[model samples]
Target: MRTITLCSGKGGVGKTLLATSLGRIIQRQEKCNVLLVDLDLSVRGLTLLAFQNKYELDRLPFSLTDYFYLEDEDQPALLHDLHKGLAQNNSNAEESQETTAQATAGPSPYERLDGLFILPSSTESERPDWTPLHHLELNETIDKLGKLYEFATSSLHVDYVIFDTQAGLGSLSLAATTLSDMNLIVLEEDDISWRTALNALMEISALNKRLQQKSHSYFLANKVSSSMLDTADKLKAFSFLPPIPFDAWVQKLFAHATTAVLEKDFEQSDFFKQVESRVWQELAVILGARQRTTGNGPRSSWWRG
Candidate 1:
């Protein structure tokens, strides 16, 4: 499975929204299993972005909060609860009913986005009350999470597992990105944002070399204007996701509380169509989904399970 982590060193750059849209796009286009895991504990806002009307989170049997917020001794039991909520099991009666689609996805964690799942870190972030990271054992939390991540992806048999991370390059974010096959960074078109993002990019590159592992990373300049695309182009010449203008429709989806991301035909918009063709095309290349077909009409999803 290909694991891609979407993170930003600075906030308010629309990385969360991009992750949400890509999840939808992947599900729609590829027709394969996809999981969007929310790792941003401090701000579990992406949950709202994905499931605006389905905000009955309080009634759910379990959530990611239990695994992270609970004490270490109590974590084992909580982890089981997390698993049930994420992947299918006999204990959960809903899993069987959820398998309306045939031959491929038995059941997934999402509703409309067929074969796509979302594992939110929590309905609410309990960051302040939680224990701070122990510097000496900084890798403990992320390493544990990485193992769980591996298990979850393997069991689900998904085509991709996308992680949306917390703001800044903390141990967990840094660790997760290193573990991921591709690290996607998002930033706005401001001097401070650009400079800070560049520093973090350099840090990640250095970290990859230190770990003696090659990492594939790309910087996506969010909220870019046509005029500023030139500036963004010059910022990262050697490596990046070709920066696109800030998608107005995408921004509209996140800013409004009542907006239904699924209801609208965003592809009709010139901006959305361009991204679907270009940005997502590049993304497919990174995911290794693009293959030169024998007939050469278009790439096929014949290999997806």
Candidate 2:
């Protein structure tokens, strides 16, 4: 299984949004099993994004916290059980009263897709005691995280494991970087964001070089205001993925509980189409998805919501 981690040197650069959207796209278009992991220990962004209906309340018997704090003797058994559960727990929910938030039929676009599972961080109400994590040595904790994700990819048999990492240069982020097959460092079209992202890219690149690891890194510039002049020229040095414009509609969509797949007009929107094209070109190739061609067009069918 290939693992990709979405991280940022600084916060508020739209990491979680891109992770969810990309995961959804990959699952639908590639027809592969994906596990979306939320490694942002402090901020439960992925949890909230997947926290719409009551099905996910008891979807998984354990959270990431549970995995970390469990006794050593029990950890292996629990991990084994978690892996076993992966096959039984299909991410897709059939159309039913329990699955629907509104009076709609079929799975909601906001929910997880078929073969695309989410391992969300513990919510505020269900937050586990973090004292154990604090007591563990920093390096040990980082190694543990890396091992946990490795297990997800190896034992869970997922085709892709996407990590929504915490911002900044913390041990957690480093652990994720060390384990990822590819890293996407997200930034904004501002000086501060660019500076931090450059620093992060350097650090990640250097670490991989030192370790002799085969991980690749990419830059993603997000939320470029339409009024901002010469945005492309400014970000040229970074060789960033297509820059996502700062649209008020997109901001509002993320402000509430929503997913990009739920955007009914996604295929029609020029911005989303561009983003999708880049994903198919760069991310899909990195993940080793064979480019399929049909009589209609080169890319797959447009998203139908």
Candidate 3:
């Protein structure tokens, strides 16, 4: 399985939105099982998005917080429980009366997505106790998470494991970055966003160098305006995702905590279509879902150029 983490240097830059949308895209296009883990302990936005009109956090039986504090020997059991819970939930949802094609019919880009699941962080966990790195040694926390990753990929058999991590270069964020196979640093089109994102990109680079592990990394510029695309294009050295332009419709969805990718007419929208054309294509290439031609023959790579 391929593991990707979406992180940023600053909050409110749309990392969770990108992670959710990208997960939907990967699940639909690749026809694979995708697991999204929200590691943004301070803000549980993914949880809010997933169960927005369905269930509230207080009603859920468990959350990722339970896994974080478990002993190493005990974590595997918690992981298994989470996996089983999700499987049961998916099965139950499928057994629910199916909506006719007409009911679901839409040009929505993500309407066809399936086999996607989200494990949201616990709202019960206080902010003071959120960062595992602060409570434990960084290397120890990284090792524990690495082992969890191994179990998820090997035993769970998920095709894609995407993590929505907290912003900044905090210890947890750094550990998550180290554990991820690919890191997507998200930012907006403004100068503050650029400045913060540059710092994030450099931190990732330095961490990779220190770890001596080469994982694919890229910068995603969001909320781009038509006038800013030219200026955005001038940002050097890093690969980019298809910049999501500022749209009033998107703002409304965000305000309502709605999943725009799953909404009607998403396929007909320029924003999501651009996402498919640019981000999906790049993701496919990175995850080996598509073959790349080279002098040696067709091969797969995480590098986007």
- Against the true structure, whose TM-score is highest? 1
**Candidate 3, which segments miss by more than 4 Å at Cα?**
53-56, 59-61, 71-77, 87-113, 123-136, 234-238, 259-261, 264-268, 292-305
TM-score of each: 0.78, 0.76, 0.78
User: Per-residue lDDT tens digits of candidate 1, residues 74-180?
Assistant: 86666555445455532222243332222133343443356667776655333456543424244566666776676566445577778887777766677777777
Residue-level error in angstroms, candidate 2, position 12 = 1.2
Candidate that beats the other on TM-score, 2 or 3, i.e. the better one = 3
* lDDT, candidate 2, 1-305, per-residue tens: 67788998889998887887777677777788778887776776787777655565455555676676677787887665555444343343233343233233333222265666787666343545544233446567667887777665554457778889888856667677787877888988778888998788887777677767767777787777676625653553444555677667667656664655445554455446656776545566545665434323232211101
Estimate, for each residue in 41-90, the C-alpha lDDT of model 3 and write its tens digit.
Answer: 56777766675544344545446666667676887567655444443424
Query: Ranking under lDDT, best-scoring first?
Result: 3, 2, 1
Which sections of candidate 2 miss by over 4 Å?
53-55, 89-111, 123-138, 227-230, 233-237, 259-271, 286-305
lDDT of each model, Cα atoms only? 0.64, 0.66, 0.66
Supply candidate 3's per-residue lDDT for 207. Answer: 78
| TM-score between candidate 1 and the true structure | 0.78
By the lDDT metric, which is better: model 1 or model 3?
3
